[model samples]
Target: MKTILILYYSRHGSVSQMAQYIARGVESVPASEACLRSVPEISEVCEAVADTVPDSGAPYVTLDDLKTCDALALGSPGRFGNMAAPLKYFLEKTSSLWLSGTLMGKPAGVFTSTSSLHGGQESTLLSMMLPLLHHGMIISGLPYTEADLISTQSGGTPYGPSHVSGSDSARPLTDEEKRLCTALGKRLATLAHKL
Candidate 1:
């Protein structure tokens, strides 16, 4: 069976919910499975470290997971139009994979959650794609053909799936957002299977 890693960092739970929806879409393919993982928060202190396991939610991700997955679905909450620091910090440690090209030619996609409709959800998704591009992975995005992209008032972008969490980050993923997340996962899984 092929496995697609649904890796994400969500502070307000919206992004994490998106990840789960994407996983469901991935599993819809008969031969593909989803592996969910997350990164721990970072500290400003240079020498500080997070516990091996998080106090709640998904466990911390490891490089091994990246190397072994057949495909990738990367997600993060938006922080000033970019990916969150914890996820960025984790990606910074993937130089070994970059050098070895472990992710080259793999199918990958990105997602994000934002505090407002225009609060950098698309930018955050694009920013997350930069590292995957460096890894030589083939990036995928939701196409307009998904239908939801044409009518949704909530978070769903051609760049990837997204959620418009309210200013306080209390909003949940809308049905449109959930469908887009699934669409992206299914698209990635199908492409991975073909490749």
Candidate 2:
């Protein structure tokens, strides 16, 4: 089976929920599987470090995971209109993969969760796409044809699926948001198989 790596950093539970929906979408495609991985939180202390495994949720991502994946769905919580630092920190370590063009020509997509309606969801998704683009991956986004794009009152973007958690960051993803996430996963997986 082809593995579609759903790698993300979720400070709150919302982004994690989105990843699960994306995984469901990936698994819908025949001969495709989803591998969910996450990045650990970064501490301000210079010498502090996170444990090898998280207390809960997906395990931390590894370079090997990125190297072997057939496709990628990158997700992160929006932090001031950009991706969270933990995710960026992880991406910064992939220079070896970049030099070898390990991810070149691979299918990839992005997702994000924001605390407010104007919380830079699109911009955050774009931020995640930057590194993937540099890696030469084929970026994909939801087309307007997805119907939910026009109907959703919550989070749904052509750039990818997004979630608008409340100020407290407790809002669950709306149905439309979930569908869009699934759509992105399926689209990426299908593209991987075709490519």
> Measured by TM-score, how close is model 1 to the native structure?
0.98
lDDT of 2 by residue, 1-195 (tens): 889999999887999999999999999999999999999988887735599989999999999999999999999999999999999999999999999999999999999999898999999999999999999999999999999999999899999999999999998889999999999999999999999
Q: What lDDT score goes with residue 34 in model 1?
A: 94
Report, for every candidate in turn, its global Cα lDDT versus the true structure: 0.93, 0.95
Q: Give candidate 1's error at residue 92 in angstroms.
A: 0.6
List of clashing residue pairs for candidate 2: none
| lDDT (10s digit) by residue, model 1, range 68-96 | 99999999999999999999999999999
Error of 2 at 156 (Å): 0.8
Q: What is the TM-score of each candidate against the true structure?
A: 0.98, 0.98
Q: Candidate 1: where are CA atoms >4 Å away?
A: none
Question: Candidate 2: lDDT of 92?
Answer: 94
Scored by lDDT, the top model is 2
